[model samples]
Target chain A: MPKETVSLRQAACTFVMFLFGSSVIMGVNSEAGQDSWISLLLAMLMALPIILIYARIMRLYPEMDLFEIVEKVIGKIGGKIVTILMIWYALHLCALVIRDFSEFIKVTVLTETPQLNIMLILILVVVYMSKSGIETMGKWSVIILPVITLVVIFTMILGLERIDPTNLLPIMGHSLGTIAGGAYKIFAFPFAETVVFLCLAGSLRKKDSPYKLFTVATLIATVIFLLVIMRNLLLLGPAVTNAKYYPSYTAVRIINVGDFLVRIEGSTALNFILAGVIKTTVCLVAASKGITRLFGLCNYKHIVFPLGLLAVALGTLLYENIKEAFDFLEIYQIYAIPFQIIIPVFIWILAEIKVRQDKAANGSHSPDSAQTDAAG
Target chain B: MNKKGKCFIIVLLMLFLLCGCQGYRGLDEMVIVTGIAIDKTPENDNYRLTFEIVDLTVPVKEMGLKGQVIESEGKTLFDAVRNAKKRITKKLYFGQAQIIIVSQEIARNEDVGIIIDWFLRDVECRETMCFIISQEETAREMFEIEALTHPLVSTEINNILELDQEVTSTTLCVELYKAFGGLHSEGEELALPVIHKAINNGKTVGETNGMAVFKDNKLVGFLPPNESKYYLFAIDEVKGGILTLSAFGEEHNISLEIFENKTGASFDYKDGKVKVTVKTDTTVYLGEVMRPYAPMDEKEINELEDIAKSELKKNISNSIKKVQSEFGADIYGFGNMIYKKDIKLWKQLAENWEEHFRTLEVEVESEIEIANTASLK
Candidate 1:
């Protein structure tokens, strides 16, 4: 079969959507109070180095996903153990995002609707997206990303009358330690969460540079997050923003432009759902890919449906209620470290050493043969 | 089955799941609530809720839109709301609710936080709905008055509160979100407009005027309409209002329409006491001159401007002092200003802010400009 490749632009769009996934609705950690924009900026700076490392791994193994790379670099036993860990992370992350979306809907709009229904419907759509292949998912992201950006910008413009810049006063009110903690939470969440993209990188066209894709997506997502943070802070003030479970929805609730454009928070709901669908789809695809590699299956698509069902079931049984789900986020940053930072770093370092060794071995025989050997 | 046929069957099944039949409620099945009035029962501590649901039975073109009131009693506000269904046939939808009126008794005796908690927590209730304290004996009485201009007294009160801010500046429109913020914030307190019944053209109507000041979440005192204007000026909430000035040794009164105004408060903390300097820049047009106007020279205009400035300064200082001694509530948000200006200083002062606010010294400086003579000169 011919290889399936995603264009560089499509991959960047998908990565941006993944970053915006749950953060758009859940909002960033507001522990920094009105200085949350500062925390977000700090988070982007901290995420930059890690994002570069992820891209470097993709560059080293140009045609292989992280699962294939891990098996190739580590021995068979070590690779299987690592793959099981990664598969668990991907499935848990998928369930978590699914739960966040369903909880938001249940709390805000569809109070009477059962969460199981919401999760099942969402998982079905995600499973279909995953079954159609990464190329379809990438194209869908390319089309849906602009709509999400426009909706966010539109709400920001309409809410301009309500913006009180003084709410952001005493800019450095938080101690550096508190702001750094908030930045760490933000980095683990939506920024470093892009580590999932390593599993999808195999589909990226060989001619396109992973470095450019990762950097561009991160910069764009950072700018959008900064605007969202400033918008919520300026409109709601830090006290109310921190008091609410969903600050973005609460902030957008007050956007009344001459009373004509009242209750435009529905648009915010749309933005979250669209971006969330892309994120869950990415996670589902990654988990299925890991499962296929672990079991030595011929195709990942064959088990996509069952994995999607398992994710929905896990989402439903993840927590007793919405409050517990939110409480989980406080420790989510620490929980994500091993997967987002530790394992990725280990793989990148091993890939680099292996590439150097391969180059040394092939240089003695023929310079042109190094590329073919690495591909093999 | 072929692959295409199986794919089609799955897509059809998914589409069936996408329909929101389970949670869907038709418009006719729900009664839209335009206003809510909460009162405390005279005999018990239970809440008495009066919801003014929109009367959709009458045709709009002939009778105009109207509201029908339904009363329910329960232990909590949400309970009272659900109990309202006993009298009505459908669920109360608050998505279109424009005003919430609470009785003075509830505002004075009960914790306003407990009363507003239900609205804040409910999904259907919009945070933008205006909140008001009724000056009448019972908040429901405010709804009993006939709606002369509009079919619904709640909508009429909403319109008055919204429009009066621009024309009178005697009341501040506090939305649910702003009230929630004020209740939770350490440095600032909540203040809402006061609504009452008045006879207009031999017909009773609901009118919104004056302001109710709160110390924390409990009502402390009230500011009359005239004093409320200066309160608006002190807080920089004045968009437009008439500032009447007496000229020629108090013989003739000249009403100056405020064109634009800006107020800024700066704090100076020293010797365990804080001093606030409030500076206001105002531009006005000579709206109505009691005496016939002769085209005045620049010196005359400057003199008049100084008179307007000193008059405004005296009124604003007096209003701030009245609130300080009478209510001790920082409705002007001076404490909030300090909190925003310097967090460390605020941390020191936030614990006993009320006592500090009562003893704090305030100085008012104002600059007024007569921008236009209103075509009289």
Candidate 2:
């Protein structure tokens, strides 16, 4: 089969959708009260350097995914150890997002539907998308991103009348410590979670600049996050925004224009499901690649079904109820650190050192000299 | 079979699974509730809920739809709501409910936060529904009164409250979300419209007049309809209302219809005391003149404007004083204004804000412009 590659625009769109996956429904960290927007802005600033490092790692290993790069950079045995960890991270992240989406659907729209049913239906779609390969997923992202963006912009415009600007007053009322803590939560969950893109970066065309893709996508997602946070805060006020489980849905429920444009939250629910599909599919594909590389399988697509089923099972058994699902979010921020921060940063440093050494050795030899880089 | 044919069959099967047949309910299987009224049972502390369900049996050819009231009792609001299943054959769907009426007894005695928890937490209940406190003996009585304008008393009350924006600004329309916000916020209080039975043209009807003010989650006092308008003026919510002035004499009154109004409340803190200055700018058109003649010179119009401004200033000040001395609730968001102005001062005054509000000095200033006399003048 021909190698699958996605254009730079499709990659960026996928990145944006992935960032919006669970964050849109869960909303930003409300511990900062009315200052949640400030927390989001701070999170964006902190995420910039880390995402740049991710882009740098992908650029160093031009056509190799994270799992392949790990084996090459570190010896095979150590690389296998890291690969297992990455596989767990990818699979767990996939299950977490699936659980978030299913819980939202159960709590909001389909109250009587069992969560297992929701997860099964969602995982089936995700597995199909994963089996279709990265090119198809990219194209799907390109088509769905605009619909999600339009829904968000439309809701914001209609919600303007209900928003009370005064709700944003008393800015920075919370202590700096509290605001920083909120910003850290925002950074760990949504922003740093974009590190999953490295697993699929190998599918980008040779001409596509990973740096530009990650930067532009992160910036766009940050702006959307700010608008959504401010909209929720203004529409529901700080107190209600903090108290509700899903602030965005509750905020959009209040948008009644001339009483004719009511119940537009259905559109919001659709956006959540669509974005969630892209997110879960990315995680499933990444995990499938990890498993194939670990076990020496001929193709990753062979295991996408079994892996997706595993994710569905994990998602179903992860939480007891909606409250437990939300309570897991706090632990998730801390739990995500090793996969999102440490391992990526470590791999990026090793790749940079190896690249500079390879350049030095090549510079010392003639143009016709034999290539000694076994990883290449 | 070819791959394409097999793939098509699989896709068709998946489509059937995705329809979510488990939670599906046909429209005919459920009865839509337009409004709900909650009152305490006469015998015990259990909740008695009255649901005004839309009567689906009414033919579309009829001018207006009819409503059927279903009453249930239980230990809690949700229990009472679920107990309603014993009375009605179809399931009670609350997604379209437009209003929730709480008896004055419930608002005065119970912690409103507890009463509304089910409405806010329940996924089926909408947060946009308007909340009104029924001044009648029981909230269910408000639903039993005659529905003159609409077949359902709930619909009638919802229409009257909506029309209040254009006709009379005497009543406050507080949605469930807004009440929740007020209950949770430290610097603000909740105020909802008061509904009661009234005689209109020899027929009984529900009327929304005045507002029920709450200190925290419990109702503390009531503002009369006339004073409610002034309360709206103080809070800058007076969209359209009549301002009558007897400048010529007690018998000859001039009524000015408000066209546009803007009220700005500023705070001045000195020596630990907070002073609020409410400035109102209004434009009005001469609506009616009870005098014998309709003609009025420019000088007379200017004098009339001055009289209207002073009267407005006096009424607004009086209403603020009434709320301050009687309820001591910061329904006007004076505390919120200070909090927004200076966080440090607000933090210091946050505790015991109601006590501070009771003694807070307020000054009222008004500027009125008589745009033009009506076609009569």
Candidate 3:
């Protein structure tokens, strides 16, 4: 069969990308104090030019995915080496996303539910998106995105009653270096993780969609991040947020509507599910597609069933304990920098130089291809 | 459609269908717990567990305050709740629970630490619920009172607690999570709101009298209503209040009504006796007066401000002295103030901070001003 194509709404695609990007890099609560949002915004703003670079590369070779581009950029063997590393990075990320989502659900809502069952349930939903192609993931993203936004917005409204506003005092309170360190953590986990989209960018009917969608989605993500961070700060204050692991959950529990509505701590659990699923789906798609390309398969479906099974097994057996799981995320943070940022930076620049030299050699179309208007 | 694709759609439909209907409670098996009361018995080894549960099917208007409060005797609190589960038809649902009252006798006992521990370890019990100590009556007796508004006394009790939290500091709505945080600080003593039964013409009602003071796990003493306001003010939570101040030889009391309050205490390390400076920034909106006082003049305002400051200082000082000297408990949190201010020195002094606090030099400063929406020119 022709590669199963997915028709996803631009908004949903943006939300999927935004949530996927943020989840992997940032912590629900970290040592950065109140400036966690600052790191998120900086990472997002920093991703703009890089998103443009993705568009530039995609426009140069409209029909080819990332593996083809890398192969073309540095010949077959050289391309295979980088592509193999990229493939590992993608698969590892997909596994981590599944692990985190399953672990979170198991702890939060599905306390009595088996871990295997939870992982299986999550993978079951995600398989629909991955196997059906981008269209299913995108449509679900659109359907889920609006509800998620409204839930968050509703939560923000409820939380406003308890927020003291003084908790945000002593702005930029910590040293910039500390904030930068935190920003780097966020950059690795959430922001930089968007590199997976590079795999999907070429397949977009609108190639420039990633650039436009990335910016808009990043802006939306930044606003939500600011609201979440601000809500936690206002409700818990600096002292409490620094003390608790799930500050967002505690923040919602305090929201008593004139003494009637009580203990809706489950709101954060809903959020983790909504944002976490989209993120896992993106990872699954990226990993499955990369493998199909790497192995020279005609269709990506053959790997989907096996990979989904692998995800279930990997998620179930991955971390022996919660501490090990956290250690894995932290280690991945440092390790992900190379794949998410440095390599992308390297490929982007090389692609730019090649475009320049190709312009010198082949003339106009090479240079013109990178122009902002011509990019999509 | 392919074989695998058809299988996937059917599976999705089944999963949604299964999760759509989840079981909460069966009609005959569910017993809804409305109120929980833990009180100490006269014997050292025994305690009383009181559960006020609602019959699920009854409508609030018809059942108004008619639920039975089953009392079970036990050595430990968790056992009491566990025993009650055996007595009721409906499951003990705590999701609608408003308050947990520990008798003054229970609060003062060292064994109360176990109760706080139980609160933190359980997933069913939330930290956001209000805690109270029945000052002069049994917690069960207080729960027995017929509610004025919602015949469901529990609903009324929860609402009154919420309303008072906004208006007065005397209604201390302390949560378990915050109590955990406060107790974690080695220097500070713990205090919870005091609930008591008010008998007027033999019609008893649930009344919050003051605050139940504690040193770690054990209750120390109770603050009277007036003194508890100062505690609330010190915590910067008193929303509004009225205070009367009289000169040493003045004939009558000059009352100042407070519109806003800002309170802070700082630790000063000067001598062997640690010094603490308590500050209160208050805005007073004066009510109708007694002799020798004008309601809205600058000269009167200045005089009122001075009197307000002196009165507030005296109230706080009295509470501090009573807390330090009578209770001999470090309930004022002087230890935590020192810790956050000087962690290194605090580590050295942490062990003896309680004794060091007795001689700690404390200065009370109150700044009172008249700030109204309209100018009194």
- The number of the candidate with the highest DockQ is 2
Considering only N, C-alpha and C atoms within 3 Å, which residue pairs clash in candidate 2? none
Worst 10 residues of 2 chain B by lDDT: B57-66
DockQ of each: 0.66, 0.79, 0.11
The i-RMS of every model, in angstroms, reads: 1.3, 1.0, 5.0
Sorted into a CAPRI-style docking class, model 3 comes out as: incorrect
Q: For model 1, how does the per-residue alpha-carbon lDDT over B36-119 read when each residue is reduced to its tens digit?
A: 999989888899999998898888789878789899999989999999989888898999999999999999998898888889
For candidate 3, write residues B1-377 as lDDT tens digits.
Answer: 99999999998999775573224344455566666788777766676878777755567576544566778777677776677667654456565566777876667655465667665555556667677677765667777787766766665666676667556656677776667655654577888887777776678777777777787568877888888888777767777766777743565455566787888888877655678898889887765365543345677667767877887888888888877777767767777667656666677888887788777777899998877514323
DockQ-based CAPRI category assigned to the predicted complex of candidate 1 = medium
Q: Can you write out model 1's per-residue Cα lDDT over A1-376, one digit (the tens) per residue?
A: 3567899999999999999999877758468888888999999999999999998888877867989889888878989888999899999999999999999999998899899988988898899899899999999999999998887788889899998999898889889999998888899998998888888778987768888999999999988898788888889888788878888898899998997888889888988999999999999999999999998888899999999999999998899998899889888988999999999999888887877887787675754235435543
lDDT of 2 by residue, A258-317 (tens): 989998999889999999999999999999989998999988999999999999989888
lDDT of 3 by residue, A149-224 (tens): 6766787788787676544534565667877777666656676677777776655664345555666666676677
lDDT of 1: 0.88
Best first by lDDT, ranked: 1, 2, 3
lDDT of 3 at B159: 67
